[model samples]
Target: MLAFLVAGVILGVLARVLHHEPDDPSPVLTVVLGAVAAAAAGGVMNLFLGDDLTALTPWSFTSSCIVTFVLLGLLEGVWWRRP
Candidate 1:
């Protein structure tokens, strides 16, 4: 859980930096959403793998990253479509 939160924060910051645009919402919101997505993904992965919340595995980490990025992309799309 701790590792996931840390990784999620890092990924969230990365997403904010890499995909940010002038019309987008607050950077802090983007990062928060990314972290939430990552943590949720990590928790789901751990549940499936029968591991503890803090368990750190390659697959779990990879899934967390992937889910976070995907959610960030979706968020960007939604923001883009807004008038």
Candidate 2:
């Protein structure tokens, strides 16, 4: 869980840095989304890997980062479409 959150935060910051715009959402939301994405991805990975809940693995971290970035992209798209 801790590792997931940590990775999430880092990925969130990365997303924020990469998605720079004149009118973007708050960093808090991005960070929160990253955290949630990481946790959800981690859970899915645990189910498939048959590992303990808190266990951290390279695959889990990679998946978490990927999911987080994907989610951030979705979020930016949604914001782009919003009036």
Candidate 3:
């Protein structure tokens, strides 16, 4: 849980830094999205790796950050669509 939160915050900050613009989504929203993505990633990884979801292992942390970044990028795309 703590690891997820930390990863989420890091992911959120990075997303904001990369996509900082006048019309970008709010930081709070991004942070929440990142947190959720991290949790989902942990769940999926645990499903495949048979690891404890609550355990803050390196694999879990890395996987969570990867998923969170990917999810945030996708969400940003949708949010910034021209059409």
Best by lDDT: 2
Lowest-scoring 10 consecutive residues by lDDT in candidate 3? 74-83
Best by TM-score: 1
lDDT of 3 by residue, 1-83 (tens): 77787788888888988887777788998989998889878767776788787777778778998989888998787856567
Question: Over the stretch 1-83, how does candidate 1's per-residue lDDT look in tens digits?
Answer: 77777777888788778876788767888788878888889889988999987688888888998998888888877755577
Over 4 Å off, model 1: none
Question: What TM-score, over all chains together, does every model reach?
Answer: 0.87, 0.86, 0.84
Q: Who is ahead in TM-score, 1 or 2? A: 1
lDDT of each: 0.82, 0.84, 0.82
Off by over 4 Å in 2: none
How many backbone clashes does every candidate have? 0, 0, 0
Worst 10-residue lDDT window for candidate 1 reads 74-83
lDDT of 2 by residue, 1-83 (tens): 88898888888898889887867778998899989899889878977898887778888878877888888888876755458
Clashes of 2: 0
